[model samples]
Target: MMWPFDRCRINENDLFKHDWRSRSKVQVPQYIFLKWTLAFLVGLLTGLIATFINLVIENIAGYKFLAVFHFIENERYLIGLAYFTGANLILTAFAAVLCVCFAPTAAGPGIPEIKAYLNGIDIPNMFGATTLIVKIFGSIGAVAAGLDLGKEGPLVHIGSCIAALVGQGGPDNYRIKWRCLCYFNNDRDRRDIITCGASSGVCAAFRAPVGGVLFSLEEVATWWRSALLWRTFFSTAVVVVVLRAFIEICNSGKCGLFGTGGLIMFDVSDVIVTYHATDIIPVIIIGILGGFLRSLYNYFLHKVLRLYSLINQKGRMHKLLLSLTVSLFTSVCQYCLPFLAKCQPFDPSTTEACPANGWSGNFKQFNCAKGYYNDLATLLLTSNDDAVRNIFSSNTPKEFQPVSLLIFFALYCILGLFTFSIAVPSGLFLPIILIGSAYGRLLGVFMGSYTNIDHGLYAVLGAASLMAGSMRMTVSLCIIFLELTNNLLLLPITMLVLLITKTVGDSFNPSVYEIILHLKGLPFLDANPEPWMRNLTVGELAESRITSVTLCGVEKVSLIVDVLKNHSQWVPYCR
Candidate 1:
């Protein structure tokens, strides 16, 4: 939910300079040529190289080592525990060493680092071309090692570096001013250029331009006046264009509007426009719940950091051992649980039947049924046995009951938040939505008896609404969800839920990023704090005091003595 951007430091002295709104806009051709010539080449090279590294780490390294210690194949919990322990030990060693050597800036979410860098924090070693390699390979290693962190955070930094490196070759301030004399000339700050890369990365990841832009505006920068509004919009458009073109080249004519549609559609019949007033209550409830989830996630992360620090302070080796212990536990649980083990194999008789309880192969085809003993039930579902089929068909009504789903939703949220707080590098982006969707599915099964809404719609709507609530961006959330899924019909519902979640969430706590910055003693606060606040320096905020001294003297000796005495006291000068 953290939007991709933070705050910008505006120069107070330049406030009265030519108003940007009425200034001659940069011609599309020249400005774009500059960005494309530089930003594209840099971003492309960075992205492709990063992507390649991810492929190698994920495809090559993981398969080679993970297979030997994979006890989950035999459905043995103890063996799985050993595997998890061994894997965690190896991963922690790799992560700790690599993190110290390269990509040290990637310790936490790289968003704060990006914000700090934009505010002129000196990062002498902010690798120009090398960051691409580190971000790509490091992220791949982290994820493959099962550290549970997301790639988007590091991608933000990677993108910013690419943009900065590309823009580094651009004209300096004096040259930019001289060039401004030309009517066609336009001077874009490093912020816009960096944002172009950042947004493009977000768009590339989620394939949602509006969401990416909103993320930049909301979490990236705090201050925004009308001057920046239009410029950012134009810049976002350019970046989105770049992303779209690249995606098209990658997938070739499969994306709907942007990428894979999941929730909404653009073309809607007028008949589907019927929204009763009663929908408002449910929408509001959704928003509040979303905010609660966000708060819980943040709270858990805070606790994890605190606890991990305390444990590590005892000794560095102890911390690694603790992480290794967590890994063993997780692996043990994963192996014991039937559904977690693997999807049951498909039956020849029933096309919907899943595979065995434990399979090391692809899981994309399995039905992700929920519940504690869900694996056993799923296996039964796949079996051709008449007795198993009869038992499953009879229990279907109870299995899909609303009460059962509510419990699942609660657990899903808890697990999702926990997984993210573990401090391992994996994307939290989809996990949040996945949790929300699963919860929504459970709620849908319960609410279906009373409402006309389809369960799939509920699942998608819940994800959108919860995301909006967590992020606290209503319009942007709505537009993004609509764009991402190409589902226009759900817009009204998504908006309703977003409003509900944001209202409740905001009332309880500000954005998580603000809380983090406050805790870190960072100068800026809010998406955009006051301009003066940004200009206020640490020196200005310090308290000062003055002291006076007296001296006595006479003739030459007195004069020398007086000079020494005055110098000793550092007396004030009197002209």
Candidate 2:
């Protein structure tokens, strides 16, 4: 048998005659330009589609929550209950139906699936057109149903689908003949496109281009080349630009959707925190605690997933009903919490109260007081994003009291764990941040009670530590948090916490993604091997029988070449 590259080898005379640059300069430039242009276009389309999905989810969730708040304000408890229950039930049911009846591959965060795919495992329909549609709408519905899930993970899957579609020369049935760009039909180009799309998804989701590139490098891409790094960076940049444009357009010229000039809006100017040497003690403690908590969380999450699988095996309808039940329970709890808590009369004119329009410049009716939401439910569930921002604010308002912080920490830890891996399109990123920040704030509050420490700083540290522990990501998480908050000053602390968290977490078990991959029985080769196995020699593990190849003479040259090409262990012996 001939080696694959044997026919392509150049002779010495041909090598001397070949021009250094003249022969391929024009063609190379055009090819490079086309490839880059295609990458940029894919990133742009991914961003546009991801942004649209985010907008739809925001609008739907906002409307549903507002409706409940409106009824609460009118003192119509039963009607609000009915609306919340009905909406969540129908939305979750519909989302589950789409996943079950249409695209079963569309369920979950999709990061593990994408990771597996990148590692050369083929999951059917993962990048198909049908999966794309179902993933987009189903994720939107799942998030809008008030489930404690995020759109970031699903966005990754969506971006990959878009990239695959374009890279595969578009669909055959499409009317546009020009849609078929056959430049990226090869395996190498397809993989590169998918990697670019994954990075673009992170970029669009977090508005952190640099972090997105690092995330792609650290988490997704199993194999990386120098050129792919540049391509991923370009893709992330294009995605951020397109996403920001859409956000500004949707917000009617506002700098950012969250009013902070970024995806996660936080006022960094309110409190400037200077870390003292003593602060390291608390930071270290938080890191250790975070690692243990993550280990515990992953264990429980797997057990819960197993339970869910058992229930799912009963029937598709049973799975759908379970989803609806979870959504209904969550909605009812969120809605009823405001009424259950004591309402303190809050004067909007007061210094400490929330603004007249409330946290996000809307949803003032949910405020138990005129402008104050002293209620635990309001603090925890009214709007998760806003609540997180408040916790991170230097001069926190009345809503983010120390007690409220503690309650939120406990509540979200439970809720986030259970809520994840449900029959919904939930991403662990946001929920992990939410829970981590709450604990960090709680620690900050405690420190503030004793010394003049900044709670916001601790909140940031806690968030970084917990996320690192849960995800088992070190550099990527650090960069992501830094980019997400634009808190460059916190880099030292963030890096330390992540390092510690990862060290502690890895000592116990693998990351959540790795755990899920193992649970699914995907053939993932973990880079980290067991320490005990290091002492074992290859001979100890090998079979007793051995085969050897010998080249008797010049007549066996082709045989030697074939053996060399086919078997890495073959030794060509000449006698």
Q: Judged by TM-score, which candidate is best?
A: 2
Best by lDDT: 2
Model 1: worst 10 consecutive residues (lDDT sum):
262-271
Every candidate's CA RMSD:
10.5, 6.2
Clashing pairs in 2: none
Task: Please provide, for model 1 over 28-107, each residue's C-alpha lDDT reduced to its tens digit, 9 standing for 90 to 100.
Answer: 35554554455455446445544443334434333522442244334464654565446645764565445445544444
Could you tell me how far off, in angstroms, the CA of residue 112 lies in candidate 2 after the best superposition? 0.5
lDDT of 2 by residue, 1-575 (tens): 11111111123354435632454656656667877887888788888787677666656766776677677678787997899889888888888899888888888889998887777666767888888899889988887777777778888888888888877766546623452344444566677888888888887777778888888889987767899899889988898788667656756744222333344223344446667777778888889988888878878888887888788879888878778778877787766655545554454554444533332431233645564555465454445556556566664434355665666677677677667766666678878877888888777766655444577777778888888888888888888777765657778877888999999989988899988887777766445678998898766766664476555635567776787677755333445
Q: Per model, how many backbone clashes are there?
A: 33, 0
Q: Output the lDDT of residue 506, model 2.
A: 93
